[model samples]
Target: MAKEETVLQGMIDRLIEIGRCYGMEMNVEKTKLMKISRQPTPATIKIDQKQLENVKCFKYFGSLLTDDGRCSCEIKSRMAMAKAAFSKKKNLFTSKLDLNLRKKLVKCYISSIALYGAEIRTLRAVDQKHSESFEMWCWRRMEKISWTDYVRNEEVLFRVSEQRNILHEIRKWKANWIGRVLRRNCLLKEVIEGKIEGRV
Candidate 1:
């Protein structure tokens, strides 16, 4: 492990040198280090005698990534963002438009927000339950139904003429992504198939 850290530090040094040749300097204060592992240990990586900040979680390409490699936090973040987006367009969803059109809008707009990066998510039972609940919540809110209304989830689906398809949609995306990766000859395929050496 110490040897690997030394190699990483050497590589960072080379990168810094190359960036300097291009007149680009790395912002040590803005840079963060996150060690992704089942059991992450503290990693100290320094640049120019300054240490980078370590984070338990950070957003990368708009998706939350954590040290534990779990997607629950990302899922919750997506759900909250989706709910806020729904609230912003509440009028359109609850408008007197055709029910089918409203449902389409929800699927096109809200689901896209909630399911962003879901294809790569590893969901547990609790996560799946949360996703289903979020789906039902969207429908209920669109129908203007309150929790006190005691409306069953099925009733909400019935009113919307939709079924619980969030999980199915996620599975479909995973399948498509896997198929595409498998068809290509790339490092990602090797990583996915565990062909890379020294992988944790």
Candidate 2:
């Protein structure tokens, strides 16, 4: 662990050198650093005598990543994004389309948005509840069922002829991702197995 900062600095220096060789300059001022740890301390990485800002959370490839290595925030962000996406196509989803086709559309669009990078997420009971709630929200909105109607989730599922399968889908995705990772001889597999050298 003590060598982590040194190794990171070395990598940064090498990257800078390569950029210079390619006539490309790195914008150190715009660069951010994040360290994932249960008890994280401040990291000071300097470039051109300017310290890079350390962030508690940041977005990468449309997914929220936090210093605590927890995916709760990411899940919440995904839910929000999914809701926004649903709102954009609210007319189509709530149109007079066939129930089966609407369900399939929800699965392909809203669910995909919500489940982006879900395979790498570590979901707790609360996260699972949030996901289920998002799933129900989608169904309720598609059916144009008002919250004041006080319709039960089972009734909603029955009306939609569907089951609560978001959690199941996430689990399946995670299982498949794990299988692929286990079969590969790569850095990710080594990291998952805690077999990386110089890692504490």
Candidate 3:
């Protein structure tokens, strides 16, 4: 059994209004309507607002809406949509660290580690003091990272360096779209939650 799309929209609107009356506003800029039920599915309804973190409050009410009816799959499927909506409402921003930049950074870092070779211990020792070299080189358009990790010589001696090219590549792709939206939403949520207060 399922509810009609129009009816669902109406219910959502009413809930939004109620929330506003309580001094909490719905993010109208990110609101959207969609049909998720069969054309003639019964009177059942499902409402979810867990991902609407940008809104001060996300309230829903309906006899047909139930908690047990929502499955994990449904929640996971809509997570990206919710993130995107939050991004829109909050106008979140992210740095444009393109793929090329990431690739160069990883490649150079890995190469430095490789130079230390099979005698990983010695390589790790040299890395302790000269790690800044990589960042400096990168700062000069050579690709680098400004890391502030302090550890004893013994710890660095056992440090193993491995190639993470594929992982970095995947990150680049995600950052351009889904990753960017999710990160922005998370940052916006933090700002709204009193954890971090300032203009996003």
Candidate 4:
């Protein structure tokens, strides 16, 4: 931490100096430094001689990044957004449409909403449970199978007739997204290269 703080401060100082040389101004009010570690920073970071606030978490690219790096916050936020999306099209889900049509709607709309920001996520078992709960909730609603019906979960899957469950969909979408990222030879691919290679 000591070394990283010193190096980070030096980088920030250089950035400010370069920006000044180019006659560019940084928005000091919006500037803040986030340290992603359990240990407190030994030194304060400054931008243009102003102290930057340290926060436990920060929102970036529509995802919640925390010091501990747990993804629960982001997952909950995604669930809310996806539920809202489903609610927006409630009429379509509850309509007398074909089973296949409603299934398509769930994939196209709610799945898109829920799976946003999830492509790069390393989902833990708890996270997977939450995701699966939401997916089964949708399936149950689509089949009009109340808890009172006392039907087995297998029955629900049988009723839906969709081969790909939510987890499968997640895996497929994430694979597709990663393929695109890899094809572009992007920075993310560079970061993931060693992990994927080592695992193989």
* Top of the candidates by lDDT: 2
User: What TM-score fits each model?
Assistant: 0.87, 0.85, 0.20, 0.78
Q: Per-residue alpha-carbon lDDT of model 2 for 82-134, expressed as tens digits?
A: 99999999999999999889889999999999999999999999999999999
| Alpha-carbon shift of residue 44 in model 2 (angstroms) | 1.1
- For candidate 4, write residues 73-188 as lDDT tens digits: 78888888988887777888978999888998988888888888787887899999999888887888777778888987778888888543778877887999989877667655
Tell me the deviation in Å of residue 46 in model 4.
1.2
Model 2 residue 131 CA deviation (Å) reads 0.3
Clashing pairs in 3: 2-42, 138-143, 138-144
- Stretches of model 3 off by over 4 angstroms after superposition: 1-9, 12-34, 37-175
Q: How accurate is candidate 4 locally (lDDT)?
A: 0.79
Q: In model 1, which range of ten residues has the least summed lDDT?
A: 1-10
Specify the poorest-scoring 10-residue window by lDDT in model 3: 114-123
Ranking by TM-score: 1, 2, 4, 3
lDDT of 1 at 27: 94
lDDT ranking, best first: 2, 1, 4, 3
Clashing pairs in 1: none
Task: Show where candidate 2 strays beyond 4 Å.
Answer: 1-3, 186-200
User: Compared with the true structure, what per-residue lDDT tens digits does model 1 show for residues 42-79?
Assistant: 78889999987889998989999998989999999999
